[model samples]
Each structure stands twice: as structure tokens, then as C-alpha cells.
Target chain A: MIDNIEIIGLIAGILTTSAFVPQVYKTWKSKSAESLSLTMYLVFFVGIVLWLIYGISINSLAMIFANAVTGFLALLLIFFKLRFK
Target chain B: MIDNIEIIGLIAGILTTSAFVPQVYKTWKSKSAESLSLTMYLVFFVGIVLWLIYGISINSLAMIFANAVTGFLALLLIFFKLRFK
Candidate 1:
């Protein structure tokens, strides 16, 4: 049961991480983020950055990993939005 | 110092949860998810679901709240996608 739950957690992490891929690809391909929300991304980037710090403070590897990657992706979007806008 | 970090964490939580809102609004208003990837949403939905479960297991209010809202938003997008597609 424990192992099963761990597997589920792992799956969850993988899914969320990969889910951003399409948006990443779309932004990368079009060099446009007009459809994306700049305000939201900026706020979210800050939030994820905090989460990363929290994860680090708490020594939570999973949170650290997930938020770090998500933050990176969010940052990429921010970059494109600024560059293309 | 600790209080400040808590504030930061709270802001982070809020940002991530709210980040899904614009996408939700856009999807709702457009009645289209042509730019959104179904596969990514489905996977992210599952991941958030697991995160919710994990939150429950750990009794983490912040995780539970954030994931629940995000999952709900994701579900709404999924519903729109299915209905419009």
C-alpha cells in the first residue's frame, strides 16, 4: 500500500512536469505569448520561486524538484513574453 | 524572519492557485482549447489529484488548498475542451 502510494506520487509528479511541455513547445514555436497571461505568469513565477525556497528550507526533495522545474518553465514563458511582446 | 517566509509561502500558494484562473477564463470565454493540449491537461489533472491525496495524507493545508483549486481549474478546462471539441 505504501509503495503503491509512492508510485502514485511519482506518477503525479511526472504528469504535472510534462503537462507544461505543450505550452513550452507552443511558446517556443510561435515565439508568441499573446495567448498566455503575463500577469499570472509573473505572479506564479514568484510563487514558485518561494516554493522552491520553502522546499529547500524544509529539505523536501520532491517539492524542491517539482517547483524548480515548474519555475524554470514559468521563467521561460516570461522570457518569451518579454522578448516577443 | 519566519513570519516573513510564511508570508512569502502564502503568496506563492496564492499565485500558483490563481495562475490557473486566466487559462480557465480564456477557455471558458473562448469555448475552445485548440491551443491547449489535452494530453498535458489530463496528465496534470492526475498529478494534481495525487498531490491532493498526498496533502491529505500529510495533513498539509497549503498543499491541499492549492492542489484542490488547481485541480478544479484543470477539470473545468478539461470539461470545456470535451464540450467544445
Candidate 2:
């Protein structure tokens, strides 16, 4: 039961991390970061980075995977923000 | 060093969770869920829920606090989405 729960957590993490793709794609395609605040995304990126480090420290693959993908998506958004705005 | 790092993680989690306030407030005040995607928020909500459960299982307060606040905010967003749209 516990293992099943963990597996669900891992799966959920993956899905959420992947869900950012559409936003990333839309932002990239439109060249618009107007709706996305730079400060917020920057801080979010940093937070996720720290979370990734924390995940590694605890040897938690789920956390690491989730944060890694999230960080990547956030970075893309940040890049678009800088590029367009 | 480790304790300090964890503290920082906890603080970051809090700030990020707190950062969602403006979005929630705006959504609530404007009564607009046009910019927000329901499916995304719904999926994100469930993901955060699982993350919270995982955090509790592993005895990680940082994750718990972060996801709890995030889930609450997401729930608010969902409520707005339903009410407005």
C-alpha cells in the first residue's frame, strides 16, 4: 500500500512536470512573456533548483525528476522572457 | 550546513507557496479564469496532493508545507474557474 502511494506520487510528479510543456511551447511560439512575471519565474527556478539539490541529498528520485523537469521548463520560460521582453 | 540548507529549502517553499497569493487574489477579484487553464490546474492540484502525501510519508515538512499551500491556492483557482467560467 505504501509503495503504491509512492508510485502514485512519482507518477503525479512526472505528469505535472510534463504538463508545463504546453505553456512552454505556447510561450515559445508566441514570443510572449507578458503574462509570465520574470521575478516570479526566476524565484521559482531557484526554488526548484534547491529542491532538486535537496532531493539528491535525500536520494529521492521522484523529487529529483520532478524538479529537474520543472526547472528546465521554468528556465525555458525565463529565456523566452529575456528574449521577447 | 545541512540543517541550514534544509531551513533555506523550507523558507523557499514557503515563499513560493505564498507567491501564489496574488494570482489567487486576482483570480478571485476579477472573477476571471480565462487566462488560467482548468485542466492544468486540476492536474497540478492532484500532483501537489500526492506530493503532500509523499512528504508526510517521508516526514519532510518542507514538501508538506509547500504542497499544502500550493494545493490550497490551486483549489482556489479551481473554485474561481468553476464560478467564473
Tens-digit lDDT string for candidate 2 (B1-85): 3386578669768666765676676666776666455776777888888888888888887888898888998798788889999
Query: Candidate 1: deviation at residue A5, Å?
Result: 6.4
Clashing pairs in 1: none
Candidate with the greatest DockQ versus the true structure = 1
lDDT tens per residue, model 1, B7-56? 65566778888987887787778776766768778988998998788666
TM accuracy, model 2? 0.81
True contacts kept of 2: 0.24
Write the residue-wise lDDT of candidate 1 on A1-85 in tens digits.
2465455555666678778888888877877676677887887788888877866665556667788888888888888889988
| Candidate 1 CAPRI level | medium
lDDT of residue B46 for candidate 1: 90
Clashing pairs in model 2?
none
RMSD over all Cα atoms, model 2: 3.2
B62 Cα displacement, candidate 1 (Å): 0.4
Clashes, model 2: 0
